[model samples]
Target: MAKHHLDPQYLDPNYEPVVNRSGNTPFGDILAARMQRRTIMKGSVGAALAGLMGAGLAGCGSDDDDDRASSSGVASTELGFKAVPVSTENRVVVPEGYSAVAFLPWGTPITGAYPEYRPDGTNSGEDQEQQVGMHHDGMHFFPIDLKAGGNSSSEGLLVMNHEYINQNALHATGPSYVNGLRPADEVRKEIAAHGVSVVHIKRDSAGVWDLVHGSPFNRRITGNTEMDIRGPLRGYHKLVTKFSPDATETRGTLNNCSMGPTPWGTYLAAEENWHGYFANKGASQPREQVRHGVGSESRYDWELADSGADAYVRFDITPGSGSAADDYRNEANTYGFMVEIDPFNPQSKPQKRTALGRFGHEGVIFAPVREGEPVVCYSGDDSRFEYIYKFVSSQPYYAATAGGYLLDEGTLYVARFNDDGSGDWLSLDLEDPDFAAKVQAAMGTTVGDIVFEGFENQADVLLNTRLAADIAGATPMDRPEWGAIDPNTGEVYFTLTNNSQRTEDQVNAANPVANNQTGHIIRWQEAGNDHAATGFQWDIFVFAGTQGTETVVDGEAVVTLDDDNIFNSPDGLWFDYNGRLWIQTDGSDDAPYQNNMMLAANPETREIKRFFVGPTGCEVTGVVSTPDVRTLFVNIQHPAGNWPDASDPRPRDATVIVTRDDGGIIGA
Candidate 1:
């Protein structure tokens, strides 16, 4: 059943690019436009606003003009793929005949008792705790395919990951605190509201997919919920805590980022920025302290002012004679694992798979499952110079299997790249000779094994995956973000977001470019398309650049294009089922590229065209599509608070849908 998602007119023939100054160049610009149209023309695949785009993304362009010269050949009535224009006022947009709907909006109820969100931000942590979580990111829709003569919602459970909370947005005036201190009341509220949200959605023959709010299946997995820790690293001394009566389970999930869907109908969500939650005493600590993995980036700043409680005082692990014995010195070890949520079972307890060694996980892209074969997942470490890891589940995945717990068992490994394009999937086993060699080499067995001996526990291995990967000698990358797996081919694509901080001297084969601020997406086709293979070939697919400027850093001329081709940072990513690669940007210091955007690209063509752009002070994040192709959902997040107070009515960041008119498909 080939379904049509967009209309032939997804981009009407009359659709004229605002500034497609093909073969045109601006004098005194950083560089001249070498814009030329080429074959396999790839274009950015997101929505755009006629107004803001004209104002904000006026000159922004792609790597080539040859890309814009041809028609997509997709007709509205036969729309194969398209980009539609929807309204954009600090919100996500889709093409005309398309619509934007808000789901899991900020302060949306997570629990049944939570109060309704009053746009003014008065919503408290009390009732809001159990409701749908905030800042929805990567999501998936599993259709409820019922046999004949059955009443089933065309829709299924909408499983989404809440990246992080917008305190100012979540609370009307930023994070609520008592005298600059996080109130336990507030912490408690946030704890209950941060994790995964599973709610049922249904669409009728008329194509309206509405949320069944009271659906018994609606559920939320918060930070306080108990999660069983599994994998090689389970039950380690480092994970044993005074809080965990049995020492194997942990209390919460935080910064849940991008996701993956199992062939067997389960949901996989990766926890990112888990490091920001701990409180480190800076680099002044001892070698043991540094070796313990505590650095300047811990979360909670709980050290500043202890509300004298776990909700506040638990973050600081300073061993300077202060009694952390009864507190959470070992608490940081609990986070940084891949959490599995069964969307079908609302009452199912979310489990953190420790076998997937932890780090700042951006996503978990699984290797397409094959019966009787090992299941593999690729993940990127978000921080600068972090490593990319892969998890080979111990058991083979069976699509028809009744049990969904297979994901809990797996052999987690990290990658170490070679200059000659060869790599190794370094395993993190305490008893392995390779592990002993690394410990002896880095820490000298005496201190190495003891300092990180807690990693001796697989829980330590899974929870502190970075450390395990470190001991395994994995290759550090240029701040890896989201990853996309090609559905047509089994190749895995991961983004190495910009890292300008690295000096030329620090450049290595893996992170080949120095001061490589504008990042690149690296694609690797597993040998035989086998994710379980220990080796794979790799290449730099698209080096990000400004629309029409050629950039030469330390001597490599990456890309040159027109004004529209210019792009600063690359972050969020999604490879639509159609093979169109959708890219979202997060420009941190590259303020010149104002109004971060989302670009649609053809992976095979490598042609990136600017499809949709965000509003003033908003980051374009969270991208997903319904199966029908009629509804396209994108999230406009953290909109404008970096500019002024959260109350400015100029625009409120929210999700919007885009559907074509005449009931035609999108981008046909």
Candidate 2:
């Protein structure tokens, strides 16, 4: 998204023209009706909602327990640490009793010869391949013992997504271009810097964490890594590229963002804002290109490399006079899906699971997995006016044998948030009768160059996911980002980052603010406590804005923000084993809260407090902790000022490890 006073060196790849033509109701209108009914009493909206919907928000599931397959059980739901005040300082600020240390920063070597980090940004493309990439986002800590079916927190593979790169910061001075062509080596380094990093990190006997360089588990899946194309859309004609003539595979995963960990011990890195890396120069682009915001120029111009190597030129994605196999027209089509990688297998090739409907996948969050039930996961498109989605595997999940293949066949559905606070899951399956009817009704209708009639098969629907969701009448949200599932309540919460383009007439109940620069969080409960259930009940969980701001409905204050909990752009959300909802922010540093931060919340009581504040000009995102919850790892991305080390003027994005001085549980 667009940050405040964003550096000219950093590009907001997510800044694309509004492509949603869904004429369906916006979430703000739904909130309007919901607020009207609850505002009858004179109390604040938070109190009214807690009194009215608190019980429903807490599902039939029992309190926190060890039922979760990933993280350990929580001691309590309350946020144990004291709230940390926001700061504009160029250093991380945590609670008084906590310690925060930077680790695995950009260009930190982990494999090969274990090259050391060069603060001057003098690392070569080859050097970057052996080190951590830039702009860390969503991440997870997979205990090494978990591979053997044991849970040991001392050692693990810390897998994280490098969302994007800062060309100015990646190079020593800046990029060099000759007559509009970029140096091949410069382009190569940029490509190497965009992807996922798997580092083998281990804690010493004294509880200090450090990378185990050259470990077998240390690997980097960069933009040049070859990955298998899997799922329903696999082998589809649209995926045919010059590199993957058979459409069974593609080279590289770009713009990786928030991630998800599978029950079978795998990492799913989401491809977000990938379209900005490719340009379609054709006079008239296809529906896939036009709808995805592929334009005449790319963000990094990798296609304009001086060498013009196939590896670099593929970023152009322009169709040639020859067949699809002769050009890179289908290159972008191979992106925008949840890529599954086995961190434990160094030789394993990441697989793009297309069964999870593709768009700008902010991240994927699985509902608690079951032995014989379908595996269900939810992902948001991470764009203004986009829709939330859920996927239910066609095959039952067997933990002993479950793998990415289970994600290959599934029914993907988009959410439709009704004005009545009720919702339905509209299946995108071409075989579904209801979806087929919706497609038929939308056929011949055009949005830009896209003819709805062209969506004749499941592959087409999956390829053009956003358009399909539009035809299905899914509610347009305010830039839906990360989502989390509460283990205690079975309730799902998602961050609806701001949508500044929404006009007064465009306001809906869920997104009540017209020019909502400050975003909000929305939570829902699956009907009958089943994630696969077609029906749901949703409500506004919290509105993020300046303190004293009130969301008024019919001359009555519905939601009034207090000073302590005020924040903006809730981007990352995760429910720890103890059921404390951790909310991370990625927004402008010009408000009641002057910097990006992470806050902990009691999901049941809806009490929120700031826990950690990031340095100046950085996004507080991507958080995970050890199985014991005693240690927490958070990512500070694209810092403007020298953080972690003031001696280095060039700021490097990094992971910060937080631990209590008493060695107690994180957030209690």
Q: Tell me, by TM-score, which candidate is best.
A: 2
Which 10 consecutive residues of model 1 have the lowest summed lDDT? 23-32
Model 1: per-residue Cα lDDT over 227-346, one tens digit each: 887765466666656566445777778877778776666777887766556665644643323433456534434344425665545566543343334556666777777788877677
**Residue 353 lDDT in candidate 2:** 94
lDDT of 2 by residue, 169-220 (tens): 8899877778878889898999998899999999999999998866999999
- What's the CA error at residue 580 for candidate 2, in Å? 0.6
Error of 2 at 520 (Å): 1.0
Residue 161 error for model 2, in Å?
0.4
Q: Show model 1 residue runs off by greater than 4 Å.
A: 1-101, 146-153, 175-182, 204-206, 280-313, 316-325, 402-404, 430-436, 443-459, 504-515, 549-565, 588-592, 641-653, 662-665
TM-score per candidate, in order?
0.77, 0.94
lDDT of 2: 0.83
RMSD of 2: 3.5
Model 2, TM vs. native? 0.94
